[model samples]
Target chain A: MALTNHPSETPNLSFLKEKALQLRRLMLVQAAGKGQGYLGQGLGLAEFLATLYHYELRYDRDNPEWEDRDRFFLSTGHYSIALWAVLADIGYVSKESLPTYGADESPLEMSTIEGRVPGVEMTGGSLGHGLGIAVGAALGYRLSKRDARVFVEVSDGELQEGSTWEAATAANAFGLDNLVAFVDCNGIQADGAMVVPIEPVADKWRAFGWDVIEIDGNALDQVVGAMHWARMARGRPKVVVMRTKPGKGIARLEAREKAHFIRVGADEWDVIAKELEAENA
Target chain B: MLKGRTLGMGELERIEDRPFRTAPFAAGTLAAATRCDRLAVLTADLGKYTDVHPFRDAHPDRFFNVGMAEQALVSVAAGLAKTGWTAYCTTYGAFATRRAHDFLAIACAHGGAAVKMFAGNPGLTTGYGGTHQAIEDLALMRAIPDVTVIDPCDATEMQQIAEQAIDIPGTVYCRLLRGNVPVVLDPATYRFEVGKATRFGEGGDVGFVSTGFMTERCLDAARKLETQGVRASVLHVGTIKPFDAAAVAEFAGSVTRLVTAENHVLVGGLTSLVLDAMQEAQILRPMLKIGIPDRFIECGSVPYLQDKYGLTAARVHERVAAWLDRSGTSAAA
Candidate 1:
């Protein structure tokens, strides 16, 4: 309880709740601008991204490349809608440029390219690379003798990649306590309904020598609590298996059969935006 | 009471009539690390084969062994480079390219990470067949934009690249010739430079442009050709990607015809580079490629494979003499 980072100091639940809604609204705006996107996954990840950007992560808002700043590596690059929305909220990205997402000659590519975007530590989207990069960055922190941590966001579907396990093995072998992985267990993938089986996910991570913290990812309290638990954990890396619902905030989007990518018609953008606002209101 | 067994080693063959240096990579790296404050060496359980054990013993805190995961090995190095550490990684060329190519392509190549990959057993150097050999490493690595590709001739060039490649920006992939490597090039006369080719011998009839340990073979073939009144010149191309196009074109212009050789496939290795260089330089020269064919190589001893694949110096000399006789070109002409 005595560890003094932003997570403990900013125990204001209401602020984080507002930030989560705001992230959803901004994500809707970005997706609506492009007329379509991986809106379902982005909507589901709003709560976690809100928790990370507003509470857990430590970064200089003025300088994204600050050497000692805590990093938040978005492993699934298709989830750039969520990152764009959150960083825009943090003022790291200009809110006016939100419409240019996924457009031609846009810095806001559907997938992240590291230096092109600020606040993005690694260019993700090629599944199974985030954990290893986070582990290396954590080791770099130790080598440089800094206290800044490395936080990574991965999906349950990404576990199917063998390289992810290789990274998981190395993370435990190196004993990277400064690294925390948040796996979004959203139950669906590109080929529909998680084609490969990754059940007993918590047990697998536990066997891989990590402190496992499972939580209902849409719930802000549990997300914050898991962050606190991971912050206090010592001597081993941590994995917070976040069981999230795709397209969580809006009912119409959630009820759709294909929630992996929410391709809404142009006329439906206003309705979805209003629905998102009404849910929080 | 333990039973000893021979470790299945790759590419332990050495060139004759030259001074040998033990673990020149380690010696060269130690010297480089002395000057740089933030240099670290890493390997994926192949530390014994890579000769990084000496560096590991000297600076234990700076060494990392990330099990046998090649993808993780390259990804971790890219991550380390992102955080301001020049990471040096060593692994079999097969695993480094075939297995971890995506990691290297996206993580290191796209981001411009300052990681150095010392790929061992490149082309047909390994006796472990296709599974362990890196047959098309030159073509694969050279295609990746902004990455420096190198294949040193011997111990002298290997040691020099080890020191110089530290300061080379972005990423680098070099064919590692280690464990009592032959000293074909004299450091006093031959200096290794990035994207620079060095020429040897006084013969102007046949120009042999070669890379890797095949440079030694070319020099030997040149000596063999010289005794038969056919003077031949040998051009050693150390760096393959930032290729010495100007040197290759100039060398092509000077000689009557060209013989491009490497320990790799002729499709996209040194032969491709020379063709590209001549095209840009607009110099048309009759070129003969002496190297591995486009197919899967079989498992055999190093000498047997070298002789079978036409990579030996005698085979190269025989091929060049035959080509000259067919073309009706000699030293008298």
Candidate 2:
């Protein structure tokens, strides 16, 4: 109903790239205090999130809960490692709370809890619920004639959850073009590899009547371009399947055999930090 | 207090050709939506079955049918709440709890979403066998943190709850009685208050703490008890969570004995809550719990199932008389 599909001027690609590097750095700093976390997924999602928070989403840091603002849902709550980093960078949460992540009584929980942070629209971690919630929000927004878009980030591992398909079916049934689902296909799960086969991810979404786009998630330009295309209200929900390496920025972490949960040696913090900085430079 | 034009498992013993409110859930929810502009009614493909067709027909723009996906039904309601819509959804109680328990837990209740869920076929109200009978829905819904659990007793309470549950903060899971429902309480004198119980008659001999439409049976049992010289009082506890413990304790303290009856299992239901309340008050009164036993119930007519499971008024009265005689307590009027 509210169709503003015009493409905007090019976003500063270099700036977005540097912001991705900063996100990776902050992720390491948060993981360093605990020495163990969901770092691999966090590292892989830096560019995807950086492009989203820094450029794509229309939100106000001053009024994080501005009712009509674009909403971002984190379906993979374990990626709070990346969410906290991005929110902190955007001033929604304090940078000082980064070290306390995954700590007891911390607002920045290991997973995304809705009430803990104002920016977190939903409590995620118990997989396969965010997309449906997004669908509801998109429907409500459209009903009220609000043009703000709903963006939700999920994972390939989460695709195995049956509720995900249920939500997928409903979104297409409602013809919710205002909703966009980013499937962060990192190809790893808590039990090493995917316990269930969720291959042909884009085709699966297409089967559900979604407008599908498959891209290299780490590529910032592609992320922006995909978002640009997703802006058009094409009378169907959209999904972007982003195939990304588990650990993208650094070679040592990227080459790890099992990267679901990363635990660094107490002495390896400085080395990993240098690896990230050197690669970006 | 008898209803007419009944069908299926809703048939009662005293059915007569009298006026009755048909589809009270649909009528009440439609009325509530008319007043609240922010209200949206959705059903998981059980619109007519769950008696939500009135809301669907009256407010077409505000109604959404999400096929038969119970999980999405709940999550989408929660999501709708996030975007500032009070979503009142309906489905079979069995599916709302057993199928979408996780969605209700993490997505709806955890976030304190304004998703008012109406569960049709509460307890043994359905003849659709184990899969459709939501016998443990009250217990399952009550266990969720910050959830308002309600069991409306009749057409009056069903209509009242639809108007009231929206104002109840956080999420609400109400057990609804739909289709040719009996009106037990007078709407003029009764108001559906959360965390409160309604007392029928001030008899001091025996007080029955009951909920759901089982209160109707308890009322009938009380009248039968009166003829046998036992003055029986019925305390209708509609809200299971944020339970009216004070009322239970007060009612327990006054009566010589207590009887907690419901259409659900004995465990974690009204009986368990009554015991907890009495225990908390440190009152060691002899109590009788009348309800279904632990097992999957088979498909049958309401009267047959109620008779088989000892939930009918005749069974309730017989059980109480036995309890009184065995205890050697004088059930004086």
Candidate 3:
């Protein structure tokens, strides 16, 4: 909730780096307890979420429904664990709601946006639905001539949903400059590799009429630069293809294929905790 | 008292200047409407078909055309509502109910997102054949909880209710029958509350309860019943879900026989709503249902199917007469 020289001054890269590390740690804790969560996605997307929450997104932790605030929608609902960690780290949610991650009664379900977490928007777990919602919000802001922007985060695999393309085409056709789409190209899904071959992802976005930008998602500078370019690009919607590893923070998990859902034994968890401590150190 | 309005083609042209042709828009006319400037409109290439074109023209920035994708149409509308914008998504009933029902149920209703969905040509109002006609929309839409389903009798009612949908803070699935329907209810004399019933006629021996476009036909049926010494009452049920069970049950219990009709599949629509209300009120009355049987209606002119499905006034008369004759009931008591 602290404002220092309007989001770009001094660019607190160190603080953002610390936040990303904290997000990975929280995600690891939730994954350790449940034996699963979208830990790989949360870990992979930690840097992007950290940069957006810290420097880009204009949100109020106290009032999530503040009318003129910027809007962010997670098109890929399965990645809520990563989102939850970033939200908690930013004081958007109570620390007590953290451990009840996948519990039945908890509003912090595995993948749902119940407005409980400040700045969390839209209840989305279904693929292909979030883009349309984001487009709608962006359209709303433009209509009201509000400075609020809309950011939608999607996965590489989720591009298969027809609704995503439908909404993408619409956003471009409408020339919605206030909308930004972040495609997390982590190269793995429930089945296997994305597209079965190397895809010209940025070119594809450009062809679809979007102002496309690509970056190393794990790198905080590139992520921030791409976001800045997105904000600067006018008269067209923008998309950032963030190339990232499935699990970035933990080495053993990053090397494994099924790291999509990790289950480390108690001894292995102690190793994860030690690695997290080393990262902090 | 909805009485004596011109019917047939040239309906939209006739009422273009007449204010309050759509309910959601009419709700905007009154100053007492909700200040939720989150009021945005989304249409799937149906800006004119669903009669939201006026709103689009008036508030260009607040209007969106999502092209022909009905599924994305509702999904996006739900998303906008989640972000504190009161969004109204419009499309044809066939597409809105059949193509986008899952999104309507999950993204909009189950998600607890306050969005309004308006569809044109619910039932047989569309003369454009089977594809455009929403014979099963009520059947599909009524099953979702927290979804307020409405089928305005005519353009006047549509205008009035459309305005209310904007101010209302919940999800509403309303049928939009374009152009001139037989304007049977007056906007002044008869109140158009979302969950209330409108009494169209009064009689004793039989009652004709209907919703949507059939309310007018039921009035004609009541007129014919009068000449035959069979005094029939008519209850116009505009709101299908969160149905007016008390009025329906009270009428069904009081009348000798109750007949329900609509231009839809005989399941999950007006008849089903009335039947459920009967059960809830524990009124075991003999009821005859008049509607499209369980089958995919073949594409044709609206008149062709109306004759085939016995949705005409003459058929209603004959069916009611037959039921009354079989029971040997009279209103003399």
lDDT agreement with native, every candidate? 0.87, 0.87, 0.76
* Residue range A86-131, candidate 2, lDDT tens digits: 9899887888889998999899888899887878888998999999
Q: Tens-digit lDDT track for model 1 on A1-281?
A: 21223555557789889999998888888888888888899889988998888788888777777787887888899999999999899887998888888889988888888888788778897998988888788877777788988898899999998988998998899888999999999999998999988999999999999999899999999998988888864789999999999998999998888988778899988898888888888
Candidate 1 clashes between residue pairs 3 or more apart in a chain or in different chains? A77-A125
Clashing pairs in 2: none
Q: What tens digits encode model 1's per-residue C-alpha lDDT throughout B98-119?
A: 9998888888888899889999
DockQ of each model vs. true complex: 0.73, 0.85, 0.51
> Proportion of native contacts in model 1?
0.60
TM-score of 3: 0.91
Report the C-alpha lDDT of model 3 over B204-319, residue by residue, as the tens digit. 77888898767767888888888878888899888987789999998888787899988788988888888888889888778899998887666555555566788877777778
* CAPRI docking class of candidate 3: medium
On DockQ, who's better, 1 or 2? 2
**Model 2 chain B weakest lDDT span, ten residues long:** B1-10
lDDT of 3 at B176: 70
What does the lDDT read for residue A71 in candidate 3? 80
